[model samples]
Target: MLFNKEYYSKAFEYLLESTTYLIIGGILAVVFGLLILEYHTIWSDNWTVLITVIGWIALFKGILLLVFPKSFNRFKYLFKSKGFINFLTVFIILFGCLFIYFGFFSY
Candidate 1:
């Protein structure tokens, strides 16, 4: 199994990159959701800003994670111990999607 190091490392790298992006994306989504909920602003005023922030966060986070995979191990341990951040993330994403859907498509 020594030969699997390459694959394992690649997998770990991708996981670290993607998870960090998702976390940052999730935070941006929530922040936008709150602004949309509280301010009643048009999507034109908020969507681009939120998306740009989230996009940049993802891009930078991916680069950082790839360059320093060791740092993410601490978060993995914290997440494993909590066991609820995943669920919270899922709920937040679902709520954000629902809000967006209703904001644009529904009266």
Candidate 2:
């Protein structure tokens, strides 16, 4: 889906059109974030800090989606921008590489 622009755009459109789906997704994100934080709240180490940050970001993103679903409409324009998509793809690739390095070689 990430590599397919048409599919990606359609999926984004579907999510934007379906309010119920957004609400449900937001609820799930909140629940998952809370659960993550519940067990890994301390930021004592790199892994703990990363987990805590992810939890916090998830919690905030869910809240934003729930409270301002309409605001996300602005992002629809971004999905159409090839530059933005390229940037996102590069970022995801780099992030994945870092994750692999940390998970395997860093140890």
> What's the TM-score of each model vs. the native?
0.44, 0.83
Q: Which ten residues in a row have the lowest lDDT in candidate 1?
A: 76-85
lDDT of 2: 0.80
Q: Write the per-residue lDDT of candidate 1 for residues 6-71, one digit (tens) a residue.
A: 454455446555756656645655555555545543346544455455445555565555466457
lDDT of 2 by residue, 1-107 (tens): 36786767667777876778888878988998899888889877575487789899999988987997777777877777777767877888888888788789987
Residue 5, candidate 1: alpha-carbon lDDT: 37
- Candidate 1 lDDT (Cα, whole model)? 0.54
Top candidate when judged by TM-score against the true structure = 2
Kindly report which residue stretches of model 2 are placed more than 4 angstroms away from their true locations once superposed.
45-48
Cα lDDT computed for each candidate against the true fold: 0.54, 0.80
